[model samples]
Target: MFARDSRLRQWLGQWLPKRPVTRRDSPATARGGQGDVDRVRRQYLESEQRFRALLESLPKVAVQGYDRDRRVIYWNEASTRLYGYSSDEAQGELLEDLIIPDAMRDGVIAAHRAWIHESVEIPAGELELRHQSGELVPVFSHHVMLNEHTDEPLMFCVDVDLSDQKRAHRDLEFATRFDRLTHLPNRQTFEADLDEVLDGCRRRGLGLALLYLDIDRFVEINDALGYEEGDRLLIELSRRLSEQLRATDLMSRVSGDEFVLAFPGVHREDDVMRVLHKVQEVFRRPFGLEGHKRSITASLGICLFPDNGAGARELIRNADVAKNQAKLEGRGGLRFFHQHLHDDLVRQHRLAESLERALDNNELFLHYQPQVSAASGRIENLEALLRWEPLPGQPVSPQEFIPVAERSGLIHRLGDWVMEETCRQRAQWRDAGVKLERIDINFSGRQMGRHDVFERLEAHLRRYRLGPREIGIELTENVLIEADARILEGLHSLHHRGFRIAIDDFGTGYSSLSYLKQFPVTSLKIDRSFVRDAPGQPEDRAIMEAAVFIGHRLGLEVVAEGVENAEQLALVRDIHCDLVQGFYFYRPMPADAIERLLVGGVQSLGSLSN
Candidate 1:
């Protein structure tokens, strides 16, 4: 047995015992010994074949075996498929030369030597492997050390393909960084790029320009043409803008109809202006949307690094401030960040802060402007206008604070307050035996789009014991044009609840006549622009007359806004306008003063009718 053990060890490098002759060295013992030896040999061959079959059957995983010296010993078909190498080419080749990239060969060889000599295990995880085609293939590798009794030490790597996973991850990343509509970098990626650019500019002490651009009157285009058409126009605009930008510069669509451009290193402020002028020139041509060639302009706000701000957030905020200033100054213009712009923003912030407390401090009040009937010239309806008188300061203009409220998301609470207050005042007038016609209250787009507006207003009416007919909801034309289904449902629901809907600033928006027909509107208030010059301008008079004619034909009342003189009033009345609201008949007055006028029983407002 000892001799047999040594001989088998020499043959197979494995220790095996020789079975004793069970029949005391007879013929039976010899036959049994031969049978056992033959059985052991056959078992080894079968196990080897099974292992080979397993490697061959794996269609998606590469099974490669290498020696301690990192030379390839075995390469399966899957290995060939993955690495673009045939078994004849891969086998007996150095693993480093076969799969390891030039930069990683040394490290991989060292790791393999450590695993072989020191019994240190190679850590298994996902990594990229180089294919013969020079393409990088992602794979999750599982390593096994084969230390068979008869065979030399070997390392086997079973790699599962991770190419699909990596591709999916790349696609997800792209979707996250890009906007679906314009296929441009979205706000997140844009802001990140801005931060990176700002850091580089700061380090080099370079002048950088950040331009914030808003498409002028984009809302009108969106309302006039459908949103689908608007999307096409935006795509075309993006293409045009991209054609004008340098490859080094970054342009991103930060918001709806708003884009951001970053110039990391500029020689002078004039360079920034030159780039902006190029951008302006890009939009000089019209973009054809739905067969209509519509011309659009951009309002640009420029802020310089190291001058306006040193950081990303500060620069963006200041640029936004300058942008709003540009819009206020006039559209189709550009403005640089200035200290006064910052001061104005500070003032706006202060005003917003005051407005938050104004409602609580009872500083808010409503002034009613009577909308008189054109036929009898008597007070028919009154429009409730909001006023704010914060203590220790002059009255804040609604034009200024209202926009602030809208931006700061305070419009929701402010609008609710105004609605509730108007309702309460109307209830007071009723209790005082003063006849109150329908009081028109303005509704911002924010208010109209709210899901809870209907419920909130219903509660207010119930609280004041007022019916919906006692008041009206006035919204600008853009509100109806941009209204989603939820807002439309809300409007229709309000109309069904006996609430009157008025399209304020009619003819000022880009909505087609179809919207006027589709919406449940009770009146169209001709915008002040037409009424302001109707007495002289033929175009103005023609528009005014058309507005009135359309209103009457649609079974809706027409109210001429900004009627500040007898001549304008006479012109609107001659055009057969149903109602007139402006300073000419009665300026916006306090509730008590309006109550006096209501109680006076005057058949005419002021001396216009008399």
Candidate 2:
């Protein structure tokens, strides 16, 4: 069954079977034949309606037909929906005017003409076509030529809307390379762009300041509030930090609570400081954290290109080292990567590499320093110290190698070795009948963060046949201030088990009094800086007075550290300090040397006694 159009009817007639019923010999035969012809006609009409329905119903696929002139001869409902044109409005319109963008019109027309006349197939491809409202629409369009080889060939186009696919692809790419929370370039993109930016700088002989910034004590903030609040804080911080950079600068979110920035064309220290100060100002202003205003600060690490590092990884690593240095020197400050600093890092790396096998090689050992009573000059207990000797006459100071071990994640191993050796030494002293009240082991803040720290400590003591009372842990004031719930809880469990906890190097750190009081502390060690001048200066005397008063008030033993002279000892004695530690009493010595001192009952340094 042909459509209502005469041309379609003529075309269908050539393809359909006809049952002709003319005057026949029998009327019955003729009637039967006419019924067959009627049935055939009805079937043809149904097929035609089905074909038309299929073409019109496609929601995202538009089908349009054109004559040799490239004018729209047929436009289905999908075409109307896709191009924002009614079928009536699209019919008789030129295909170029209907959907071809101005820039692509000529190429589209040429491709159509070649397909129509030269029998060349139009390549099916994606295109940005113009919508009726002047917006661009993405489409995957293909062609179908009907009645080809005839004088009046008709070409039908099948166009699929590709907007959804393209949009999805774009979103996936963005998610891969950006921080979803802050919508900033993430580590992957940052490293990639850094390489490109470094190349440009190399070509132009330009210098840049690459700064790595870390939000100090961010873990405490995250734990005190929640992760959602943490994300909000990071988003706001990114916004504020972004406002501090020039258009030429690049910034990226490298990790949680950490950002890396690059300032191009900044070669001089003055220029570097300018950008550094701008970043610092961002933190000086208080932030609204969880609906409460809180002052936040960051440690900034700077690395100058071509001076500090030669590549992206090098720069990032060096910048991180400088940032860590700032954090170590008390945060909210900046440190530059000097050549000497890089050399020191190289040495640390070497040391760490060496330390990986130091335990097996027996290159590590422990020394004991005695802490004595300030008033009677009687030894109370010994402080265990760690020492390293990589080679003969090549002793590496704990000050240098301890940090190297911590950063290399070898601190845990070193700490285990220290504990085992210290316990072994104490057991030896006990067997020899040399009495020691208890010995204290210095615990790193990093080591205290272990989730299984309590179990590990208990296991160590059990292995040594020592109770918690025979061993104690010394922590720094910074450690107490920065301890999260887990660490503080771990400390409380240790303290509850009768392990004495002392805050080492007190009054020399940015320890919050609020947080300090919450720690399970039994003693406070006055920092050497205050005691070094306490015997002579009024300010130092005042600081020592306040420290001792606060410590005793809290039921903690106040010990004056770095008491190297008689005057300092007498002053601490007057201040009622419970213990004294420094070279004035006994220098850190090998276990054998210290054992002799203990077995001989030589507790006090009589030469230094007042």
Candidate 3:
């Protein structure tokens, strides 16, 4: 409507028949042809009547009749209501002066004259004409020229108000095509646009890339500030990113702190990298938020057109999959979409769904690996390892499913189950006069987020009438390093309660010694990678020896993992490591096997060694 509607003028140019006028001054009337003149008068009157009837059928349509001079000769009641002019006041007014906008008045006058003198008809469609009060009014108008053969030809315009329809169309377009806050293209609109670009790419044999960008730790930042501030941050971030995009490229705020961008004609990995570099540069600049400049980092995932996927949805999914993998590696990293990555994500998703029902379906169980005293060759402790078999003899390794559990938030339940089962088994062992000094269960950092973690452990211990000394909790070095105040406090309380605290797979995380100082840990388990080369590699051996010295200096017991050879075992013993845990002596076994072995007698490591 208004001047912005490019189609209105084109859509208004269809057929409208011209009617000839009957003039009493014609030659027929002056040449003694009174009958013919009378017949023409009757025909003109009949045509007027039919036009009036049409006006009556459309009460809301404004009808105005003008003479060849463009002076109003007829104005209907609807015209008075629509243009804020009484029929009496409008009768002798010039058509352009009365209703046409100043800018369009010239064109409207020229068109009217053409219809009157040149046998042209201004057909029907939408227009925005001025009202008496000067506001623009959207209307669908039909123009008809009557009496084209006579000098006193007249024109009538029938206009139907299109205000409501225009408003509705504008509102629907805004709702569906644009994001409310950022005013960027929405996910649906972006996808539809990508579909069009993809069609063009297919025809032109071109390549494109779709990138999924996610701001790291945005949720935490959002929670720290208020939601209103968060929204502003998003708006500002989107603006800056938009400034970096090319005019031809398209970007969409697909979710909170996540944007999807399409780059057409990108052919190589280096080309994709250059685009990603620009994106990373945007993040590197500090953003203004709540009177503060906060630096942020984002991870980007990229998928190529006709290589990763042909369709928009598939490409977006693949890019998102790559983004997730990049997130796993840490902030500001990028990953390319590949088939194997997509396949793994699909498998992980399916595994997570199945793992939800794993416990109740009795598909989950634990195998305990023993930690033996290197000095006495006697069992010192057992580490509980979770194992899963969705079907008989088809065990899914922890490497495959543990991450699935963590991502799915099933780790909390699984952790509790392991603690409860271990405690219950210990109670049963106590009942059979079998002494089990300490059994540790592993924990992922995700499990520590549960507010009831300490309570759940206490409940399990209390239910089984077990002491805290008999249950140890093993956490990876990374978990302890990333521990927040609540997690640190909870672990401290557990340590204070005499539940043994062990840092498992030590020296494998960032600054392991600093975490050992920060976290209240009682023992350290050297990572298998370090232990595997302890005998031959001086660097590895020196690292292990240093770890033992540091642990002892801190009054923490140190154990070596992956002791699968006599050389590795002897090295651990020579270093005076507190314990040795590996397949050399015994592999991880089910509870029943451990129970049978414990009941028989003291297990001799020397006799079991290969």
Model 3 residue 41 lDDT score: 68
* lDDT (Cα, tens digit) per residue for candidate 3, span 1-610: 1122324333322222224554558565578877765776677677667766666566688878888898998888888878999989998999889989999888887877666566566656688888999999999887655565888876667788887789999988998899888999899999999999999999999999899999898898878988888888788889888888887898999988899999999868789888888888787789878899988888889899999998999999999999998998988878988899988878888889888878889888889988888877677789899989886558898998888898988899899889888998888888888868988988788888788888898899999998988889988888877778888898898888888898888888887367677789999899999989877799999999999999999999999999887898899988989999988877899988887777764354553652
Question: Candidate 2 regions off by >4 Å?
Answer: 1-43, 56-58, 71-74, 106-110, 176-249, 268-296, 305-320, 360-362, 369-380, 391-393, 424-436, 477-610
Q: What's the lDDT of the predicted structure labeled candidate 2?
A: 0.83
Query: What TM-score against the true fold does each predicted structure earn?
Result: 0.64, 0.75, 0.76
Query: How well does candidate 3 score on lDDT at residue 75?
Result: 88
423-473: candidate 2 lDDT, tens digit per residue? 877877787788898889998977777677667767777887987778888
Where model 3 places Cα greater than 4 Å from the true spot, the runs are 1-129, 133-135, 138-169, 601-610
- Candidate 1, 1-610: lDDT as tens digits: 0011223224322221233334455677676777776887776676677667877898898988888676888899999999999999998999889887888878888877666677666667777889999888888876766563224776677788888898999889988999888889998888788788888877888888888899898888889887888788889989998998887788888889998887878649578778878888988898898897878888889898888887777877888888888886667978888988899778888888899999789999999999988766688889999999888689989998888998788999899999998999999998988987789889998777678887888899899999878989899998898898888888898888878899999998984888978988989999999889878899989988888888899999899999887788788878899988887788889988888889983433444454
Q: What is the lDDT of residue 504 in candidate 3?
A: 82
Checking candidate 1 for backbone clashes, the offending pairs are none
Using lDDT as the measure, name the better of candidate 2 and candidate 3: 3
The deviation in Å at residue 68 for candidate 1 is 7.2
